[model samples]
Target: MSKEGRNANGIETLAAETLQRVMEHPATQNDIATVETQLGRYPRGMVAVGARCVGDGTPLVVITGPVLPGGIPFPTTMYLTSPEAVKAVSHLEADGLMRQYNEMLADDTNLRAQYERAHAAYLAFRHGLAERLNESEEHIEGISAGGMPVRVKCLHALVAQSLVMGPGVNPIGDMALERMRNEFDPTVCRCVRAQSDGQETR
Candidate 1:
């Protein structure tokens, strides 16, 4: 498990499991349609680089964890030590979430429920899907807005697959840590790994 008590892969697992829940739950289509319609209305650039959606009707579910944005090196990067290094990487995702959330909050202002529900769904799926993946408890994002609550729904990863988007660490050895920064790319298949039992939905 990564620092902040979460599994490294918890995020993706959450999305997948949540999609499954959505399918089983009565709100599947409506929720998905709303998200899709918004996505379609959204400029292609926005959705491709920054949007993330989950839930499809077929017997398949795909958890899509968005590496939406944010990646600033701590001012003292070179001299950074162990726990510090860990914390730096650990909180990276949380930092990204807020970057997006703050922007969303400005417009929605009162949409805390939406964010919380999304987070709760994310957490639930993380736990449930862990059992499915046979992976040690993994943390999706080490931190989320530090604290927030929303509707909670768990996904069933054992019943779904996962798709992630992010960057690649090439042998540009010099670009080592630099390569870890977020690079939003819709067409780019960030991570295409599949579930053993679940179909290769991604």
Candidate 2:
């Protein structure tokens, strides 16, 4: 199911968008520290990835792209060069794309083996993200390393902010989304969490 959002572009749009967001994620040496301080990120307990939650930003990369030929290694990948931004994939492709991704996953013996080996990791991440969003707080960020432009990053933010974890993924709200658009910079946007319980998600 498609969630409502300011943008409706598909994953093809997000592939390039991912590259663009990386370009805008310019983090100075202190940006991560600053964001961590602002978010009060502290680890609740012993987690394998982060030493502590408070000081660390969970890096999530959404591999939003086409299901490349199975022969290619890493058909989809993400970059986290931007210090300010964590990671993101397009509102994730729709069910169709996911099916194709899985189909390709089954075909590529090496990749399929990798997917099996990492299947637990994938489920854990999804579980963690769902838990995080359901329980306390969660924010979305997209960044690029090549410096394509800021608008691409903002577009990703738009998609991320619009997402909601409901019976099915959807958009949060229109006004909440409009609130993020910027006339200047055009690409950079501040993602605001929709505290409303019945809120829609993209």
Candidate 3:
């Protein structure tokens, strides 16, 4: 298959996986509440829980709608909500991992191609979500979060996409996750609050 064909197939697979996740784990009020606690505010435009903590089932990442309630365009689809995960990625960003990834992308053509494909897949996935929500994609067309295709701006955004879409979809995200393996393990529950208790106290 040609590169375009492969890209299209990748996009379709990702879109299908996202929709299936939505079907299987539809967002609940409790999930919103938990995410709000994790984020220290109510999550806006969240459509579904993209990924949950393997340890305690807390929402680790959320899938936001393409447009907000008032028709505001939101380009970020996958948002990291786990406090532990956020802190780990934030530490990596503080250590200048993004600059290293950017430098790597500048030197490696193959990596650049993969990053471009990831960007395309992100756009496709967002568009699919927009269609599902009956929202316009005009405002955020060709726009994806995390400084994809050219730069590594936000490790948190990239890592969120990686956790939601799984590894190999975003190489930079995979790298970030790998680098932070010691600090953040999704398999182990690192959530500060015990979600099972249903207590709002943090």
Residue-wise C-alpha lDDT for candidate 2, range 90-201, written one tens digit per residue: 2222213334444554566654443332322222233333343342212222222111111111223222322211111112111222433342111343233222342323
The C-alpha local distance difference test score for the whole of candidate 3 amounts to 0.85
How close is each model in CA RMSD to the real structure?
A: 18.5, 18.0, 2.3
| Model 3 spans with C-alpha error above 4 angstroms | 194-202
Backbone N/Cα/C clashes per model? 11, 26, 0
Measured against the true structure, the TM-scores of the candidates, in listed sequence, are 0.26, 0.23, 0.92
Model with the higher TM-score, candidate 2 or 3: 3
Model 2 / residue 176 / CA error / Å: 3.3
Which 10 successive residues of model 3 have the least lDDT summed? 193-202
Predicted model with the maximum lDDT: 3
lDDT of each: 0.30, 0.28, 0.85
The digit string of per-residue lDDT tens for model 1 on 1-202 reads 3632353344455556444553343324443333333223311111111123222222112232222124221111011111212232335444453344445545563465344443444355444433543434323443322233421111111001111212221111112123223541223334333333323334
